[model samples]
Target: MALFRTSIRVFHSSTRKMTTSSVTRAPFLLSPNQVSELTNSGHTHSVSLLDSTWFMPNSPRNAKDEFLSKRIRGAQFLDLDEVASSHELGLKHMMPDSQTFARACEKLGISPSTHVIIYDSHGVFSSPRALFMFRSFGHENSSIIDGGLPRWVDEGHPLDTAAPILPEPGTYGLPNLKEGAIKNYDDIVANSQHDPATNGHVELVLDARPKGRYTGTDPEPRPGLSSGHIPHSYSLTFNLFLQKHKTKTGQEYSTFLPPSEIKAALDNAVGTAEANQIINGQRPVVTSCGSGMTAGVLWLGLQLLGVKQVGLYDESWTGYSMRPTSQIQKTS
Candidate 1:
């Protein structure tokens, strides 16, 4: 009996260690100060800072044009619409397969060993989505710059106006991608509804669109797609996680609110019990929004609140709304 018990103990101990390593926690978000510190500490070589700004088709200012004109010194651009997305027509900004993703990272001098730091021109918009892409690709040493370029400039950091000197192409090989870090329509479809078998392990679908969009009342910015959110998903606008601040020059910009405020907002969106389950890591959360851009905002907010099992619905409502078989719900 003693020998049998000893074997059981060893098995459980080894299992725990494996589980711990599998879910390694690196810093989720970094301030501009920390990024500057790392640069000054002679750590620039291993770090790949990404400018992952994106704009809607109707937006007047082009993200790429803005990057070429002015960007954080030593920041490479991650083209979400062109490089990292699926090649399929009309599926805007969907996550590419592993090989395509590896190639894109390689072009940007990002190898598996690279420490990626993402930020966007818009304070807290698309960088977290880029971070999600990197993490889903199994690159563990990834983080987002808090407040992004707007805050960086507000703090009097230097910007590079000249053309970027691209680094030598990196040898980013195939990675052990984390399947659970991104969810497809099928996964959300399967897991959105509650079931007794998945009592404690349910995946909560969270919509990051505005209340009007969530309720099918607002017209979708993208043409030809139906309005309304996925069934069993809660309406939580991505902007709720952001707080606007004015600079010394009287320019206004948005930045992430403190974790406490974020937690309160999330708790209100999803009920207290469900939010607690998600925060305690008992349940998973999947975030989605129009064309998968603002979904990152919610994904980052949840990460700030220390929720681990969170994912981005890469296709978001763009694909869901157009699908003939899918069902959408609206609340009055």
Candidate 2:
């Protein structure tokens, strides 16, 4: 009897350790199939599915209207612009204050323990921004659906066109922002002119805009904003982390590249040595783009690569460019 009891105790201890390990290794990206399984399993009461689609000013499509027309069943619309705080420099989707974010999450039925799964109409585009927002507000139990709505549609998963029924408001508190998760204009300026001897560690600022915009060879989509990259920043267009796929019916969608492919893309973008520095933790990375939306793509990509010391510049280029004294760099 004593020997049998000892074996049972060992088995229970091993099971507990395995369970803890599984929880810690939870993925930040969930596939369309995975999401479907969870929904089908009747576990959605503890999960919040959010459609986080957004478009640039030049785009004609409206995100909310499309969400109303079609979305994952039981999903709610999370308006990026509506939940954000206003920026003095006319930037869109700036990170909201703690109270505002808490209220937004509570209204969305997203308590701290709720597992948020976000998706966007344009595959992985704006969903990362939504995920980043959740993480910034200390909601670490969040993930983005890989390939988003397009992939879900491609997989022949059913979408609901009916109006969504809102869940009861959840109880959430004003969580503090994660340290080093956000970077401001002044931080950028200091980093741009960083002296390793004084600054302690070198930080890499990566621009997620297209090569032409980074080199000042193409006009910015936003009117009156100058086309130029930030000083000491490297251009690694957000699209590099994604790959296009075609459905059986000839519809096309984008999905994130595998980790190996992503590493190769980083090497190609910043050269092998610099990319290695980033991967090996020799430098921290801060991602930026037009209005900080696409920057989240790069941020997510790095997270996928297991790089932890990453930050997002919430104001990004829009606010940076609008400042009278901001430095601008052009390669073309």
Candidate 3:
């Protein structure tokens, strides 16, 4: 049996309204201006601003060092690697157990009622993963800053270099894991065997890695891992969901493409018919990437397109490829 049942809805972004401390904003996303306004109004106590920056292992940038040097005023750093579960497979950013997650939240001064606004140093890169973590832990009162810290700086928002003050530990309790929010390796294997043409409820696995990696023409960044895709999975690079835009000061940054453009990209990736099936909830979606970080981008993109029946393969390709019995498809 699949870990996630067909009836489970992963995230309901539409029709869900969330209030950010003193300001009521749309659920799941907030603009930089709105975040600044909330902080300026002295409602920071009711909300937690988390800088959830991360980079690939090959990247020279250290997210924590960058955050320490300069970060949004009143923002606390949430290390994705540190706050995650110590996976037996050595997967990075695996969702921690409920007790562990609750403790991390408490240390960050996050109560059950506190609204979390997550952002990354890179615009819209890893913040969605952070948002997913919170939501998976049943913290639905969280949202991501629309364009992250780069956009904030592009808009002339000031950064604070001062050391962050430790937050008083909040009285947080163990949270229930959201049922069906994650898909495991067995689930993927089962999903792969289901023929979507015959099974309308079949879950679609969308790969968020680059096409080169998906086709097995390029080497995986991680050593010893085979480069290929999950059977029947569609390659939809995470960057397709984002677009580059120049700010007023001539600084260019990346942000989510508009809904129309995102939908078009989806159509291109999975074909119009399959995309429609996903959007209309006839076929559920489980997004996967090399290590599951970029997969959150696809998860968020589907939410933006109003696809409610979606989940993330938490261990993603990393876990899948490591399984000796796993089947990998390569086009090239």
TM-score-based ranking = 2, 3, 1
In model 2, what is the error at residue 37, expressed in angstroms? 0.9
The residue-level lDDT of candidate 3 at 184 comes to: 88
Residue-by-residue lDDT tens digits, candidate 2, 107-204:
99988767788999888899999999987776766788888998898888999998889989999988998899999999999899874334537688
Better of 1 and 3 by lDDT: 3
Listed per model in order, the count of residue pairs whose N, CA or C atoms clash below 3 Å is 0, 0, 0
Q: Which residue runs does candidate 3 get wrong by more than 4 Å?
A: 1-26, 246-252
RMSD of each: 7.9, 5.9, 6.2
lDDT per residue for candidate 3 within 1-332, as digits (tens), equals 01011232222234433322332222677778767776776567878899999999889999999999999988889998998888778888887888888999999998886878899977888999998888777776688887888799888889999998889999899889888788989899999987766787778888999999999999999989999999888899999999877777776667788788999999999889999889988788899999989999999888889887679998998899999999999996
Provide the lDDT at 56 for model 3: 92
Question: lDDT (0-100) at residue 108 of candidate 3?
Answer: 92
TM-score quality measure for candidate 3: 0.90
Give candidate 2 regions above 4 Å deviation: 1-19, 22-25, 195-200
TM-score of 1: 0.87
Deviation from truth (RMSD, Å), model 2: 5.9
Worst ten-residue run, lDDT, model 3?
1-10
Q: Evaluated with TM-score, which candidate comes out highest?
A: 2
